[model samples]
Target: MLERSTKIESPGVLKAGNPNKSLASWQGRKTEIAQIQQWLTDKNTFLIGIEGIGGTGKSMLATKIYDEIADFPKRFWADVSNGAGFSDLARQVLSEFGFPVPEQETQLVEALVGCLRSGQFLLIIDNLESLLQPDRQWGSLFYGDFFQAWVEDGGNSKVIVTTRERPELKGFEWLTLKGLQVDEGVALLTVLGIRGDLTQFVELVDGHPLLLRLVADLLKEEYSQDPDLSRLADLGLGNLRQLLTDSQVVGIHHRKNVGMVLVLDASFNRLNELQKALLLNISVYRGAVDSAAAVAMLPGSSAPEIEEELRNLVKRSLLVDKLNGKRRFDFQPLILAYVRYQAGDQSEAHQKAIDYYRSIAKQPPWKTKDDVKEYLEIFDHFYQLQDYNSAFDSIRICNDFLTLRGYYVDKVELYGQLVSKWEEIGARENRNYQAALIFLGNAYDSLGQYQRAIEFYQQSLEISREIGDRNGEGKSLNNLGNAYNSLGQYQRAIEFFQQSLEISREIGDRNGEGASLGNLGNAYNSLGQYQRAIEFHQQSLEIKRDIGDRNGEGASLGNLGNAYNSLGQYQRAIEFLQQSLEIFKEIGDRNGEGASLISLGNAYNSLGQYQRAIEFLQQSLEISKEIGDRNGEGASLGNLGNAYNSLGQYQRAIEF
Candidate 1:
């Protein structure tokens, strides 16, 4: 009854050649093939769905099984990589069976079903997901349920499908293909003559067959130029990781390989306008995005509307559920990069991402686990964008929060990136340029790279002097003092601090004066001038309190407590440290609280109060662990061990 497009071929196994022999070779999946074989040969089995993301070799596997199966009298295969109408599909299938395709749809359906019922046949449809639709109506038929009757009749014919999505039909065998195994991946890489720690290369690409093949080809070409593998080896993990994660690389193809851009584009083109927009929106994130972020990024759409679109995209295999049932989604790296490139005019989406992340980064000092999670996401997005101006602005806005929260490495990375951009943009003398230098210096200072810290500080100071900015000069001078103090050049640190103090007093900048006094006190304490340290700290505390700088006041109290402890005045130290701890708690400063707790523990230990020391150290450790403060955690652990040792509990100390 079906209108056949061509005559059927004689019954025999389908012959094949490995596609893209240079880039792809069929290495493994014998287990999967045997599983499909077991199901197809079973009398009760009616349908099989081979599902995976693009480039996982679904089509290849389907063809392999079709060739291996021996008993089918008639065989049919359709390359529906693009969407096809039901009539076209029926005609193609009928033509393969040496039957004429009928003009009438009802007659064709009846004839096809009758043919399958009477004789043995094998039908293989590749990319079946493309043929499905949300509405399901192809022409007086629901695509989702069209195969139900054929499958239910218990016919001799068996159907096998390869698709990117799970078919909505019931009672079908489903096999989801993942990445290739390590040995197989390595064999593929070897075909291209690209060398590395074969395991790490496979692991880097997560053993995704297409990715491994594609990246290996690129690296192979690069290696061909010199045959010196060390060039690639020099890239190291950081650079290599960046290169592999870039979706742009997947779009490349040699004469042998078809680019992933085309594969992903097929999936992307099937999406509706809103679904396409949503895909683009999510691609801006560095990693998985939760439902709330999705809703926030697209304010024009309601939450329900966004959710519905997300589900549809996931069903279409354009988006994936990163955290199952938790409502977080992600795209495959190549697919995301492809979608971002295809979705023209993405400035609006990029701006939306920037605003959302900026708001998150500006929130109160990231106290909770959720807060830290959100900031990490924000940092990831910023790092991925690599927009120097935006990154610098965010750093300035959240400077104190980043410093207090121990995000110094991130700061250093961001500043380093900003400096590169400044050089690229040729803005060596701008006001923001000096500010970036100063911040970078401060980051280096915090990391104990005092010499590097002084280099950047001096650069900032030079710029400020040329521009006649007294405030900038004073800040840079104070930063230089901090660096010198860290390097044990106390006299040099004092001279810089004295200059900063003079400028602060001359310019009537009370905040700068307090900061300078604090630096002087720290330098004197490090030099063993405990009484002089106390004098400067007292002055700094009075000024901070008078100026209503509660954060600064807390810092001064903590410093005073540390100075007193160094002076062997345990009582005085405990009193000041307790006050500092209370202030930090009131202000929701977990880092400050942890530091004060450690100080209190040390002061108590000095007084032979080992039990009190343990108690304080335990609390400090908990706070550090909660806030992800690694430096604080290390200090707390060390102090706890000391307290245990003092109590003659050597085993407990060793355990700690």
Candidate 2:
């Protein structure tokens, strides 16, 4: 029932840094690899940061690059954990880099700096965040005596840091990662032997590589046992990755997800005050927050403080720009979740931010443009509330708001709503679509979208003609003729109007025929064929008289009088004009009566009955004023002016 998709693929693969170090199996990231290699070779580059969403294969890329460099006599791996102290990181780096570690802390530092005198080497630091944990006494190694000595002396090491988040490194480079391409993603899944169709692939993996691998491993296991069984039954059946510190095989995606979380928790425990606060705020959201909005939400924080904080976060590889216009700061899901957990202890600020947006959604629109937006916010709120009826109504109001602004989308959406409503009432397969056909046609006409209107009108005519509903067929044809008339195709308009008139006359629908005749007269009038216009107007007037349609008779009589007046038959015009006025008066149509009275006054003046003309014109002008017909009143004033011009009383005529 849905239409085809219209999304484009990214040009490269994203790095989803994992907890337990995994083997490299990557695709679509050669460009990124080449860029990193070039930067590392350049003298100006100090650190290369690896960043991406969870399951984006960040760790895999790092290990692949590390494996390619076989000549490095020593390669080191450090696990970032909550309990990881400065001493632990120093121990891993010192032991793996061929540096001698002594039992005494001071002896270890001297030997580590002595080992640093060695030549060019690659330092692969994994989970760099664990270095800043509160328990890790980051100051002891970062700024403290032992680590301070190494930092001052080490000048030949190329450090590459990989974290689920960017860590707060004082001197390092950063690279934010993206996800894998569709084909690369498929290739990754295929390597695991869960070969499946598009529908199945999307249903199972949803482009999350770890979940894809996990889901595939489960299905593969199930398929190996019972090849004939369905694949969906194997979902949520296995754990693929565990903590770097723990060795456990599980049977759920959430457990693997949580395992990654624990790794992040361990890393965050090591940060100093400024770094900790930056990471905490950066992980505070799922959607990007405007740089200003984020700073505003930060209590007691100044603009310069927020900008500097965010810049440090970016430099550390914990936060990056989303490239989306509305938001400036973005975080990985896992990092955000961990930060949120930390902030959960102080829930007031977070809850207030949510309330601010909700309040914006509830504000009343003060302009037509804002009116549409106001309802849209209400619509989203109701959708979040799971109140479909309220959502539907608010959206409907948005449609109307768009309509008043000449927007086409809201009009199309409105028609869709009406169709849905009809279906809800069991009218989808309508046997009597006379009402729907006319309404849809008229709606299309209002938009000047004539094709749909013509199609609907044709279908309506066919159905009404088949059911012997002449009135409906005539009405549809008249509307079709109006559409042609609007396009300046007078001949086609005449053709459609004639058909409608013939049907109405055949069905004894006098009022319908009269209306059709009035349309035909207008078409003829537009053609400048005065004789044909008079003929049709006469026929319409006769029917209105026979059917006792006083309003219709008054209109037809007035039109006929205009026709005669245009022909210079002044007396005949007066007769018909007076006749039109009597009907207009009988029906209490002040506008119609005023117009008729103005015509009578003009005719009387033409007959040289000045006093009578003035009396009738004054009466018409008063009625015109009462009925808000300025044109009619103006015509009466002009007639009175003409009467006084003839009598040399122009001032009195203007006053009258």
Q: Pick the candidate with the highest lDDT.
A: 1
What tens digits encode model 1's per-residue C-alpha lDDT throughout 1-656? 00011111101111112111111356788789789888977889888889876667777677676665688867877655323334456655676777755433435566677667777888777656544444322211324444777777868788888766665568788998877778877876676566767777676666667656545543443355643334544323235555545666562222112324433444455457887778877776654677777877778889889988887666544665554446577664335546766766655666677678666653654542235344444443454565556556655665665565444544665566667668678776677778888888987777667898999999888878887889999999999998898888999999999999999999999999999999999999999999999999999999999999888999999999999999999999999999999999999888899999999999999999999999999999999878766568778988999999999999999877
Q: Tell me the lDDT of model 2 at 302.
A: 82
Q: Once model 1 is optimally superposed onto the true structure by TM-score, how far is the C-alpha of residue 499 displaced, in angstroms?
A: 2.3
Off by over 4 Å in 1: 1-252, 256-275, 278-281, 289-328, 354-401, 426-435, 538-542, 545-554, 571-594, 615-630
Using TM-score as the measure, the top candidate is: 1
Steric collisions counted per model:
6, 18
Indicate the worst ten consecutive residues by lDDT in candidate 1: 1-10
- TM-scores of all candidate predictions against the true structure: 0.56, 0.33
Model 2 misplacement above 4 A: 1-416, 419-433, 443-455, 465-468, 565-578, 588-656
What lDDT tens digits, residue by residue, belong to model 2 across residues 303-365?
778777776555433555544334366654445555666765434444434444445544322
Q: What shift in Å separates residue 599 of candidate 2 from its native position after superposition?
A: 7.7
* Cα-based lDDT at residue 298, candidate 2: 62
